[model samples]
Each structure stands twice: as structure tokens, then as C-alpha cells.
Target chain A: MMETTTSLSFTEDGFEAFAAGREEPQWLSDLRNAAWKKFSELPWPARNDEEWIRTDIRQFKLDRYSLALEPLTSEATATALMRDGVELGGGCTSFDGRKVDSFLKDKWAEKGVVFGSFGDVIRSHGDLIQPYLLRRAVNPNYDKFAALHTAFMTGGTILYIPRGIVVDEPFHALSTLSNGSADFGHTLVILEDGAEATMLSETASEDVDGGGLHCGAIELVLNPGAHLRYVNLQNWGSNVWHFAHQKAVVDRDASLQWTIAAMGAKVAKVNQHVGLIGEGANCQVNGVMFTEGKQHLSYHTLQHHEAPNCRSDFLYKAGLQDKSRTVWRGMIKVDPIAQRTDGYQRNDNLLLSAAARADSIPGLEIEADDVRCTHGSTSGRVDDELIFYAQCRGYTRKEAIQMIVTGFFQKVFDRISIESVREALGLAIARRVREYE
Target chain B: MIDTLVIRDLHVSVEGKPILRGVTLTMNRGETHAMMGPNGSGKSTLGLAIMGHPNYEVTEGSIELNGEDLVEMSPDQRARAGMFLAFQRPIAIPGVKLADFLRHATTNVRRPDRKEGEELIPMRDFRKELKGNMEQLQMDVEFARRYVNDGFSGGEMKRAEILQLAMLQPKFAILDETDSGLDADAVRLASESIAEIGREKMGLLIITHHDKLLVHNPPEFTHVMLGGRLVETGGIELANELHSEGYDRIRKAYPEADAQNQAMLEKEDAQPVG
Candidate 1:
């Protein structure tokens, strides 16, 4: 273990006592010990760091918040998360990093789909999920925040789809924070060879008056010939500071689709990466975000091609108003052995107010000779003629801009395969846009 | 109150450069008038100004639709008060479906007379009406699925504008240079559709330079404009005279101003709308 200098609230003693109280397994306890040392040794990302060059978080002080020990869920939170009327094979929910409840539909449970809290899943099906836990996809030491998350993870949710099983509906998970507190939750998903499944995870906070902190991680592992559809919807309150590290690994001939909607939070930072690790694997990543009222949101993503004949595509679109700002940095990386890899990435930002700003940085790092990689980014207000045309149709000025903004995001919306939740997410972003007026 | 639209002593400018000067016109229900002028003679300016385009400032005029002053209202409000302007060159807005745009427009404009709690037309009924109208305008139903005027040909954009005119069915319609880029056959087809939609109820101000469309659906009166002002008014013979004589007589008549109108028109026709 590495040595550390500064003393923080979540120290070695605090983690050891919490792990002992929770009766964590030996492997988890060891993982936390190592992660805590790493977290303590590593310093917070500074403005000079390349990954954080565009986003300045100097005002955020970690000592101002304390970790929440118990679930803080309510009936209203559950009802709101399921209001989109999406069909789900299973659902699990957590509040303030603590598991409140989880269940699988009878048919899916009979078909060997396991979805339960971390503690329960480790005790019941640890052997089945052990190999994919931290072995391949996402490592806790990827960054400082990632390491901190591993040290504090408690009652996160786990989902496993056995080989050859196909779930007809998506699985849902929601995490809610009740007040000013710190919550660190981890999510792991495993799909065996030839299996197919989709998961939709959401994080939301109701109270915006009190400041909060959320550091989270998600890991997805797909075996050969598997298909996984994953989506994350984040709508934290305006007073929340959210940081997340999410990554996925796809094996030979596997297909993956991941969509992220970052529609809330006053200050947020997320790093998402995916690796096409085997021949003929394919992956698509799409993201949409809306910000207003002095909110600052930053996103970093990577598409790693590790094997030959892999294809990866990414698109991110954002709409900003008021004094809100956003930063999107993405990279397409191809390994030396990965030849004939096809990669594409694009970002589009629409600014509704003069004070709003958006920065899009797209990078390509290719060590192979025969690869196809392309990237593009654009930032501008909507075409004036568009507003004029909509106005000619009897729409008010506010209504006209709203329609133009919606149309600006139609290309991203067209890519969503989940039909039931499309309109719901669109309405949520529309609400954010309306707040500008 | 909705039977007439009056424009009195209208003077307008774009970016503070005078475009329309001291123009007056009136349109009553059942009347079809054509404001014919050469390029840059402010024919389209009148059409845009009456519809309250923000870029074109109405410096010295009042536009009243059924006794309600339109200069005090926004473009959408003027549209809600029953006025429409078919663009000379319709803009391309990607990802905006024509059908969806029309439904929202129809709802907002049609809501003024609607009873409280009365919903807009159901989707099924709206689609049926839209398809029927598309067929009438010689447009394939697939045009509704495409983005609004995005990647459309010149004739297609013109027809889409006409389709909007048909769908919205405003009280006073201004077709600004609708026949500029169409072939003879397409012009005749568009004219037939216009006559069908503007028959005896909607007052139409068909702003055009060519007499070809006028031959298909001749207006009851034709007003000639030059140097940003009305120069003359007559029957179809006036259009025939201008087309055959090439506006030289009007230039000779106004001498200083009408001649400049002819020169500006030539320069504008050389370089199309940006």
C-alpha cells in the first residue's frame, strides 16, 4: 500500500471500521484497503492536468460533506422513476449509496437472470460474478475519484444474464440522494456468451437546496457473441456535485450500445470508456445533455480498438442556455495490432444564450496503419431562418426556440432503440430548456 | 372583422436601408390581387412587411388585419390574426418534419376560435388531411417525412411553401415570387392548386414578375410597383404590357427612380438570394 499525507474524513480508520461494521468479505475488504491507500496517495486533479484542463473545480471542497450510512428513499422516488411506463425484466433501487430494494420478474428470474444488491449477490452468487468484477473492464485505480469510489462502495447493485438467455425487456436501477451527503455506489453487469440484455440506470436527487457529492462507477462485461444495451440517465439536483467513472469491455463478435443523458447537476464530471477487445466486435456510444442556470458539466470518453476489424462510433450533442457551460473531450484509440478498425465521433453544441459556452475536443491516437478514423465538432446557435420559419407558423418566440432545439437533437434521438423512454427523456430535456425563460 | 386587410402609407427598411416607400393596398375577401414588379422593386418587401418580419422595420405605416393593428404584434401574433407569407426562397431547417411543424402551427393559429378544453385535431385525422392536401399540391406524401425544405429542389421548396399555404389556410395569403424557379408545367400545376385553395374566401396577394402564372389564374386587378412605391394599377393587360415591353415604359415614366428600379432589378436577378 502507498503512503498518504493529508487526513480526510474518509480515512483508513474510517474505512476499516465501516467495512468491519458491514461484515464485508475478505476480498472486498482487501480491495477497499488497497483502494484507500491509492486514493490517499493520489492528489485531486488540478486545472493544469490535461484531462481537467477545460474544467476548473477548485471551489469544490470534499471536507464539506459526510458519507450517508443508510438508505434515504421514499415512495415518491420509486413512482417517479417508473413513470415512463417502460417494460422491465427487473428493477433495483438505492438511496444514498444504500440498497433499498430489488426484484426480478418471475420469468427472468426463472431464466437465470440475477439482479440483487452487492452484499446479497456476493454472498449468493459471488463465484458466478467474481471473474468479471475487477479483473478486465474497469479498474478502481484508473483515477483518483475512481479509487475513492472503490474505497467507499457499499450496497451497489449487480446484474448477471446467464449464457444463451435473452431478456425481452430492459432492467431498471435508480439511485437517489435525499440531502447534503456523499454517496459512492458501484454497478456491475455481466452478459455471458450469446446472451442479450438491456439495462437503464438513473440517478436523481430531489432537494436542490443542500449541496451534495456523488462519486460512482459502473462496469459492463460482455462475453463473445453477446449483446448488451446500457443507458444512464442522470438528473441530480442543481446543488449536487457528481463524479462517475464508467467503462465496458466487449469480446469477440459482441455488440454493445450505450446511451447517456446528462440533464441535471450544477457541477458534474464523468469519464466513460469502452473497449472493443476482440475481432469483429462493434460498439456505439451516444450522449445528450442540456444545461442552464450556471451549471457546469464535463464529459470525457474513449473508444479503444484492441483487435482487428472492430467498429466504434460515437455522437454527443448538448444544448446550453443561461450561464451554463459544458466540455466534451473524446478520443479514438487503436492498438498496433488492431488493423482495419473503423471509428467515427462527432459532437454538436447549440448555445441559446450568449453567456453559455461549449468546448468540444476530439482526439485520435492510432498506432495502426490501415484504420479508418474521423471526427467532427460544431458549436453555434440555430439558423436564424429556422426561428423565422417557425415563427411564421404562429409559434411564439419561446415556443419557436424550443422546437428548434428539439429538432437540433433529433439525430441523436433517432438513434435511441428504447421506444418507451424516448419521449420521457425528451420531455425532461424540454423542461430544462423551458427553464431558460 | 376578418373580411379585410389594410396596409396604409407603408414605408419599410432592412438594416436601415429603405426597401419599401409609401405604399398602400387593400384586400377584401373574394378578391385576388397581384403585386407585379421587376426584381428588387420591393414586391417581396411588401409581402414580408405585412407579415411583420423582424428584419424589415415598418418605419412609417400601419398594417391592420380586420381592424387589429399588426405592427404592434409579433410575426406569430400577426399569423394568429390570420396572415401568411409564402417565402420567395423557403429556408432549409434539418430534422424538422413538415407534418409535425404544420400540426403545431395549425394548433396555435386555430386555437383562437377554439372553445376552452377543445383539443387540437387528433393525429389520425391530421394525417389524413395532410395527405389529402399533399396530393392536391402534386407533392408525394413522402415529402412530409423529409426535413422542412432541407435538400429539396427549387421547385420542391416552392411546392412546400404552397403546401403550407394550403395547410394553414390563413385569411390573407401572400405568394411571394412563387413561380420564379418552376417550369411551365409546374407553374400551371401550382397555379391550379392556388386557385383551388384561394377560391372566393381567402384573399390572395400573388406577388410575381412573370405573367405565365397570371395566365393560368389571372387576378382581378394587377398593381405595378417601381422604386419602392406603387406606380400603376390595371387589369391583366398591365401584366402583358410589362412582360412584352420589358418595364422600359415605367422606367421612362419615372425617369430617375423607375430607371434605378430597373437597374437594381437586373443586378438582383444576376445574383440570386444568398
Candidate 2:
């Protein structure tokens, strides 16, 4: 494979070159320029920051990775776990921030549904996507990573469902990263009133031990009475540095079920938020994480009830082995006007080794008198008696532990309606379980 | 050829404390033996030791299954070698369905050489056999869908154990107070189920304090265990005698073992319960 690095160094000159390469609308270019200015002005997150307290990034140097402007002529190798044995309404694959292959069924496309590469869709349907692009769900100036992603974001996926069109088949999007490369991919999904769809988006590296950088964002916009089931799997090699900003906004009577699973990355810091913007909006969030070696993953989540009569449920479960550590901080915030709001959040961690550690912090802030909000967190090791009982039933010691770990995550898996997602996650986790005495 | 499990002067301990000083027993396939003892007499300790419970350390003697020493093997290996123990207080495994657990277990026990991740028993055949056994035990079809032992009442737990005993079909099976905490009807159902499962097919070791469990499956040999040792061995009449009169006569006849049993009971009382 040839190693061709672009002269894009995340500087002013590089940003200008990147924007010039794409003949996008002047409005989009203006958004990128403004974001680039913010990216250059904002400082890197300090260790004392609340979200970065447990996530150390001193070892992460942006200079070690460079943006790849040209797509690799040779095919990059990566596994797509969520695409097994399912016909799709649309599918897109990107490598090193460039579109490699993408296809959308004509039936859905003819029905006023737009799905394709982000770069292509933004050009063709600029007027349709301008209002929701970094304008509503996600704030590009939230942090340094968010600003950088908006400024240099390249090949990703965009899905738009017109009013009252419900797509039965799921849309698939996969982003593959090569060793020592950087991926600034952005995913945007827009659902109009009464529109419904399911989107499965995942990230993978060419090698399990490869190194890369992924600073991305996901914005999900659900209009009135719209429903969306979004599944995101982050399986980027063990040596990647991942930082992401993901959020979803639900309008009146709309509902969202989002499942996020992360099993890779040397160090990952993610901020996930959900906003109930209109009355009677409901959202359910399920998070599953498995880490090993010296990996560290920290997730800060917020369930914000901005409107009255909204409901939100969040559950996150993580399994850690070796010297890996996971930090989960969740909050449920209900505004004063959000009367009759119902919010629930829980985090559970299962430690598989003596050295492994998990920090769970669950908080609730309710200003509404007629609302109910509850949160709970737990961290414990696998019980020896459970292993012994399974062993007595003819499972090997390692197999028993694996089964118990799988059982530990079964609660979240049960909440997932996708069968292939469950099986793929189960097998992936089982393969990583090592025999511990 | 007949299978045999012979325990010769076995000694076991828990957390550096000796529980079973010296216990010896022998049983061939198609035989039933009743072991009657009071609490802390090391009855359950013996059952756990035979199945290689990690906490039960064997300090002396040997447990042989068909001329093979089991002390060196893991619990799963002992299970694969045709041995089963129905725990008195079975632990709950949440999120693992009973049917799935048994399917993996049955596949491994039947194919002793099977490795982890190997194909389990076919769902069709396994479900059919499980349905038959569950019906014989008078269990509801929904019981198979529940998590293993999770939130089960005492009677339900005992019935689940019997269902496992019926499915595994081990060569030597130990029933560790399997009838305790059960009402009269539940005990009778459990006793009849055990008899139907093990009567001419497997060797049975029934550990209990009451006669309800021994009603349908009369023991061919009755042994009195005091202070971790068998003081006397008799026939079915002995089990009836103990049930009717209690252990007053045996305690008086065996004063030394009785004293040791009292001391162990006091020590047990001082410790916190799990």
C-alpha cells in the first residue's frame, strides 16, 4: 500500500485547501470557515475539565496523524458486523474519509427519501439539509473536537425521510480507517413529520492493532410524530484515539431508540445528549461497552427534558478486563416547565479482573414539581459461585466466565430489537474473554 | 460393565477448617443409598467435595469414579465423567434461560470430549427431550423460559434441581437435602421424580433429615453420619427407626463422634451465615 499524506495540517492554509477542493454551496463553505476559526481559537481540553478528569489524553498528539484527501485506490479491509444477512434500503462505505462505494434502492429514492454520501447529498440537497446541519441538534462550538470535526469533516452518510414515509428496511453506513490515518466523518439523519426509519452506523479499522484518529459527530433530527431507531457501533482498532459528540432532538410526540456499543479504541471520550424539545416526546438510550488491556473509555450523558410530558430512559452496562477502566457519568435534568416528565437512568459495570476498574456517577436534577426522575449505579465483580455453578453443569472455567459476561450484558441486548446486532456483539465479546484464574 | 463411585476415608475442609474428617462410601450403578445426619455433620460437604467445589479442599483420601481419581480434576470434568449434585440452595443466574443452560450442559455431558464453542445439542431434539422431562416433573412449559433459579421460590428451586437431575442422567447423583424447604406435596412430587429418573439407571445418594424424601425411593442402605464419619450402616428399617425416634440413641452409642459434632456446631454458630 502506498502512503500518501496530504498537506492538510489542520491550519488555516490546509482548511482553505480542503474547502476549495469541494465545489460545495457558498453557505456550506461559510459554515466550514467559521468552524475552522473556532477550532483554531478554542484550546484543547485540560485534564481538570469535568468530562476529561478521568480521560487522559497527554499521550495523544495530533501531529502523529494526517488527514488523507485522496481515497485509497486499493480496497481497505474491515468487518461490517451490522450488515450481516439483511437487505437494506441504502448502504454506504467510506475509507479514510472518502467514499468508496454507496448505493440506494430506487424504490425508496423515488419516494422522496434521500440517502447517500454526506458530501454528495449535501451538494445535491443543500437546501433540504441546511437548516438541520449543525444548526439544531449538535453545537459545533461545544468543544475543540466538535469544531474540528465540523471544519474538516469529509465522507460520511446522510439520510433524509420525507413526511409520512416509513422505510421498513434499515440503512447501513460503515467508515473504515487505515493505520496511522485520521477520519473526520459526520453522520446526519433528518426525519420529517410522521417519518420513520432505522439507521445502523459503525466504524472499523483495517487491523485490530492499527492506530488512527476519529473525531466525529452525529446529529439526529426527529420532527413531530417521527420515530427513529439508531444503532452505532465503534469498533475502531485498539490503538485509535476516538472523540465524538453525538446528540438527538425529538419533537412533539416523536420517539427515539438509540443503541451505542463501543469495544475498541486506546482512549475514547464521548459526550452523548438527548433533548426532549416538544411535548410528549420519548427517547430510550442503551449503551454497551467492553474494554480490555490498558484502554480507557469515558462517556458523559445528559437526558434533558425541555418540554412538558416527555419521557426518557437510559441504561448503560460495561464489562472490563485486564487493566482497562471505564467511566460513566449520567444526568437527568428536567426544567421547571417540563411538568409530568418521567426520566430514568442506570449504569451497571461488571469487572472481570482485579486490576480493572469502573467509575459510575448517576445524578438527577428535577425542577418540575409534577415530575418523576430516578437514577442508580452499581459496580461489582463476577461472582465465583456463579462460575462454580456453571462449571458443575459442564462448562469450562473460561466458558463459564464468558457466559456470565454475556448474561451480564443480556439486559441491554434484550432491549435491542436487531437480532444480528445482538449476535455480533455476543460473539465479539465472547472472543475477547480470556481465561483468568 | 457397571460404574462405581468409591470414597475412601476422604477428608475435606473449608477456609482452613476441617469439615469432613474421614468419610468412606461406595455405590454401584442402579443402587440407592440414604445418608442421614444432623446439620453441620459434613453431609453437604461430602457432596460438594465429590463435585470439586473450589472451597472444599480435600486434605486426605481419594474419590474414585470407575478406578479414576477425581481429586485432580475440575468440577466440569467431574460432571463430564458422569457425576451430578443437586445443591440444597441453588444460586440464581439471571438472564440465562433454563432451557439454554441445559442445552449447553446436556451437549457437553453427552459428548465429554466436546470443547467450548462447539455446537450445542440440536434445538429440536433438545427441546423435545426437555419437554418430556419437564412434563414428568409436572413443571409448566413457561418454566423453561425463566432465568435459572432467579427469584424462584424454595419449592420451585427444588423442582428445578430435580429437572436437571432428570436431564443430565449422570452415573452417580447426589441429592443434597433436595427435599428441604418444600411442602408435603412438593416433597412427594420431588421424591417420585427422583425415583423415576434414577431408580434402575443411576446410582443415588440421598442426603436428608426427614423420611418424606425416602418414601418412594427406599434406600438399599442407610448410614448415620455424625461428626463427618459414618458410625453405623443398616437397611431400610434403620432409616425408618431414625425418622420415628430421631438421633438420640445413635448420639448416646457414639459418644466421641457426638462430642466432636457438638464442638463443630458451636463453631458454626459463631460464624456469620452467607
Best by TM-score: 2
- Candidate 1 residue lDDT tens string, B225-267: 8878888888878888888988778877877667657555655
Candidates in order have lDDT scores of 0.82, 0.91
lDDT of 2 by residue, A367-433 (tens): 8899989889999998988888888889899988988898899899999988888888888899999
Pairs of colliding residues, candidate 1: none
Stretches of candidate 1 off by over 4 Å are A1-8, A70-83, A208-210, A435-437, B113-119, B259-274
Q: Candidate 1 A-chain TM? A: 0.94
By TM-score, how accurate is candidate 2? 0.98
Worst 10 residues of 2 chain A by lDDT: A1-10
For candidate 1, the per-residue lDDT at A76 reads 24
Q: What is the lDDT of candidate 1?
A: 0.82
